[model samples]
Target: MSELIARYFDRLAGREDAVLTDLSGGLRRSVTGRDLPDLTDRVAGWLAAQGVQRGDRVVAVFDNRLEAALLLLAALRHGITLCLQPANAEAQALADLAAGLGARAIISAATPCPEGATPLTLEAAAASPAHPAPDLAPQTPFTLTFTSGSTGAPKGILHAAESFLGCAAAFNRQTGIGAGDRFLNVMPMYYMAGIFNGLLAPLAAGASVVIDAAFGTPTALRFWPRVAEEGITALWLSPTMLSLVMRLDRGDKVLPAGFRRLFVGTGAMAARDAQAFLDSYGMAPLQSYGLSELLYISVDDPGQPHFGSVGRPLDGVRVHLDADGRLGFSTPHAFLGYLVEGALIPPEPVFATSDLGALEDGILSILGRSDDIILRGGVNVNPIEIERALAPLFKGRGFCVTGLPDATLGQKVVLVFEGATARPEDDEIWARARQIVAQGPGRAQLDARAQIAALPLGPTGKIRRAALRETLAAAEGAA
Candidate 1:
């Protein structure tokens, strides 16, 4: 797509035979940007050949490949709005999604489509004849991303390539990551964090990206070596990934050259986890705040780290809290709207969030999500308070303190611990956590608790508290 992100990459091409997009893992197939404009134009031509036209909807259910990113560009260049579904989505779900969105086509390498939708491969998209640049509308969204649906059914969040470019620019204003910076990407490209923070953010600032799908302990252990190999200067990661790497970090005394920068977001990060990484690495990871609907609201300063806050608002972004401490942001980078009934419904971008937060000296700290608070016996309970109190028990392992249905109390607090081994000391630990929560601030009482064999993670590798709630509810029902 003759859009902001693509222009950032391909604009500097044809001057040098540079390896722009580097795939770091098993399959190193990549999108070389030497003639990237030419490739994207051909891909746009391929979409034209497929009978897709302007104002059309296309869903690219692609994996973490860099080519997938290019196809996104192609879709945008053709003046088409595009959404990406999970590559591993069930056929029926994919079909239902496509049918619901009235998508003209589905693009993927191996994902199956229902009988009605057209599926195209990157090979065909790349081989077709070149098409002319589009006369793009100012505010048309090039990327259509669906939320993780942790709370309910997923809703589409629309963002223009211009929005992403603006997001990148805002981020660059804070972090100063630009030319000569190589970002290592492991997060899924289908979502906001991966696409905006991992891919587009760097490219928009004249930086290259290294896409690696591999993760977990083995990958985390080998991370710095790979950073050294790839000359990666910046790190973009989710909190879960950061915790994993922090727990299993080899504790290198002298770090790899140009590997100083690290960032964590896409989910909440506990103060202890953030502190641990800083203590180990001698540099604090930059903490940030945002969601798919709006992003880059605040980012931490790497020099003087705020222990509990998500840092200050980005340039051109304003953050204010309501009477109830609910946070709201006003930014030009906000989403266009949510896709509904095959048409775009304008979003209330200035809408207040359900999050309870506070600002102290221009720094923002989130208390917790209002929806995550448990009402027990007319007492409001913030799960984050309990989570913080029990952070030591988890020891880099994940845990969640949430509410469960209770007839008498209206709701009850339940602690679910994440681990592979069921500790013989679990009963004692649960008792300790309960006592701590009861004695601590919030005066939250635990009704019951259990240890899970592993973290109930969603498809995005984020801990799914909704799934945990369901499991606990089912167990209670069985009892």
Candidate 2:
């Protein structure tokens, strides 16, 4: 095993009773830590039998199951690089990604094996002989994650074993999350937040995690009861997920006393919703900022609550803004580089993110994405600033400010909101939104309004602005 994986296992060696509950596939099975490594060994043996060797890339298209975690550990133990593909990814996209990585094998639970790659089953792989773990360097590449691919093809981000494991351990220690905590994993494994924060970080701290199927809006309302039942202590949630949870009137329903410390990430949470959640739950959800390239950048300090800031940078993470106000960060935990056409390209010393933010008194507040800003008559209008201004007017409802293509200006500001009681033409919400934008800094003018049943969300529970823009454009064309 790589030094990092070996060290993690060593930390929990005597804690054989450490439990990992698998709530995937509608079945609950608690596997002990002692047996978990055996499963990983069996998977490693199976990969070896399939002629897979160290540094070979293996594509995994599985959900948040025990087997998926086992496979990931096995790959790390044997020095094989594992590329996690989203379970719902299209066949062609999976094929293209696997081909681009030159994956030696594809272990899929639902998707079919792509051409030229050997297919491996989780059950069969777990039945193989338990092979001894291999010794590996700390900097060995063990994981290759991809971007959301919302606008273009997903870019592969390679993470070294030591950096990946070290970041989780450091985050856990920094946050005071230890063996006493029980985390609930709701995010998909393909995302970095899912694999690192939700699963590995908790486990590294000797804490147990409850793995469930991917969370959806339909299940959002009823999820709190299960969380209470599971005695979940902490978990990372997105703004949209928290918003959906806030919609539930938990007047009579009592949450578990152990539940505390809700961390929000992926996107900004509306100020009104954040305040409402605090009023209802007696605790403000801590907002954080991070990216796939950098595991974690900053988080709100629990001791001193900053309503809109994503808190100070974590230890060893340097955060600054470029001349364009784009957030740039350098961290030891940053990914090695992007893998392009089977070749590894070294990353820059500092990763300049598309996000625009400001750091004041060591606190980082994300303004909005640079690309999401509206260019009204050549004046850059920050959508987040406008959204914050309109949040109170549309409290408890999903709303976003996006730019739509226009002839007169480069792009016009459009307010797309959710849960309208009437049609967009009849409701006064648009006028109210326009009035709020007019009062903002840029004197932003809303050119259009749209109403949907609910805001569209990406896999990680982030608002899909590109998709919403497309929806607005389609509506304009039809009008």
Candidate 3:
């Protein structure tokens, strides 16, 4: 792990002109490659002074900034395991996570540390002298990332530097993203996608990255302008973000000249939206699939994109469907294991993902999760099929179909939508949705409809289906 950090720094040592731009507050703070190591070393020295040692766990809550990046590299160099929590995470939740991991210290930028952990501010850490890097084994665990917990309690997944770095290098090679390309990163650092694909992968490819705090509706509206300003060549966004961007009125506007490709993942994008994005921007958004357990499973080729398919498996990854049609994969970048009570539990050789999917001619197309299947009178109804069919009707809006407990049918399919402020009549919207489903294949499965002011979304912009289901149940009970 330390050796990898050493090598990365060694490569940047002579490239003093290379820069990493931090765009947290709309103001750019450009740090040269030469200055980065010095910042990292200072943080490492502060960590060492605070009694941090190799194998010790450190919790950090920071936005995308030069200090955050420095902390990550410093932690890797000093052989300290890092657990990155969301910057806006609840105080009690942060405390619980720190206690569970037995964290040696807590680092925060402007945020207060939880009780029971030593507080190390980013400002203070950066003022310390340089500390010598540590020696560590390649297999040593360096990062501990938590799952989104959309379905249940979040699990802490432990990872060694070699595993993730190898995956990043392979991804860069397979995707043809390298040196001259500029990537704009807006994903949160807490997630594996944000850390591996957003930061490390681009750095490994010798590509410059523009780090933004996070992507939201405002970011979507301003995306093209930023691309034009930064000369960005590549980007990785979620389907929700793409939909939001497409909703904007770009009258007489054109896509930036240097823009190369856009990668979409983390959730299924409707085929209609994918096509519209391609038609409007003159470049199709390449779809891909991956999970925290294993990084960079598959990515569609930009030159020959299949709208709904997440492309073929990358080299060193073996993917196949299980007997139940669940997507299963084994990759060189698979995590060490789930961290349970400070102990590492070995994961299975092949991970059976919660998602149901099909691999036809090496192209992977994701169906909804098995748990998301609506069993209406013993007939399995795929929500994705219904959602895709209704996508066009609710063009700029958000909607999802799920099953609710019913007296007669066992489970009844219900459509939930994100209602606009001045939404059309509920009856009218429901009737239109039902009409679409009736014309589609899952008409018989439809049972009820409801609307919420806004859909519950996770940090990564994925709809929180489990939470949405709970909300639906409460609404149903009220009536």
TM-score of 2: 0.91
Q: Which stretches of candidate 3 lie over 4 Å from their true place?
A: 1-3, 110-126, 149-152, 249-253, 420-422
The local distance difference test score of each candidate is 0.74, 0.77, 0.78
The pairs that clash in candidate 3 are none
Question: Clashes in model 1: which pairs?
Answer: 1-73, 1-74, 1-77
lDDT of 2 by residue, 1-479 (tens): 65668778766554666557877777787767777777778888888887777778878776777667777777767788988877776767767766777887777643344443455666787679988887786678888887757778667789887777767876776677888888898887777777887888888888888888777765576678878888999988888777777676455545568987788887887566677778777887888878888788888887776888887788899986889999888888888888766677887888888899899998988889998888988989888888778776765566788898889998888777676455554367677777777876777788877677777877776788887887778877997
Q: TM-score winner between 1 and 3, please give it.
A: 3
Ten-residue stretch with the least lDDT total in model 3: 109-118
Superposed by TM-score, candidate 1 places the C-alpha of residue 190 at a distance from the truth, in angstroms, of: 1.5
Clash totals, every prediction: 3, 1, 0
Candidate 3 yields a Cα-based lDDT of 0.78
Candidate 3 lDDT, 1-479, residue by residue in tens: 36677777765555566557888875777766777777778888888888787789888776667666777777766778899877777778777777888987777642344454455555677678888777788778888887767766677888888887788877777789887888888887666677776778887777778888688877887878888998999988888777777777474446789888788988887677788887887888888888888878988976788887888788899887889899888888899999866677888999888899988888888888998888899988888898887776775667778889999998999888777453656567678877777777555546887678888887678888888888888987998
Q: What is the clash count of model 2?
A: 1
TM of each candidate vs. truth: 0.92, 0.91, 0.93
Local error of candidate 2 at residue 272 (angstroms): 3.1
C-alpha RMSD for every candidate: 2.6, 2.8, 2.3
Kindly report which residue pairs in candidate 2 clash with one another.
1-134
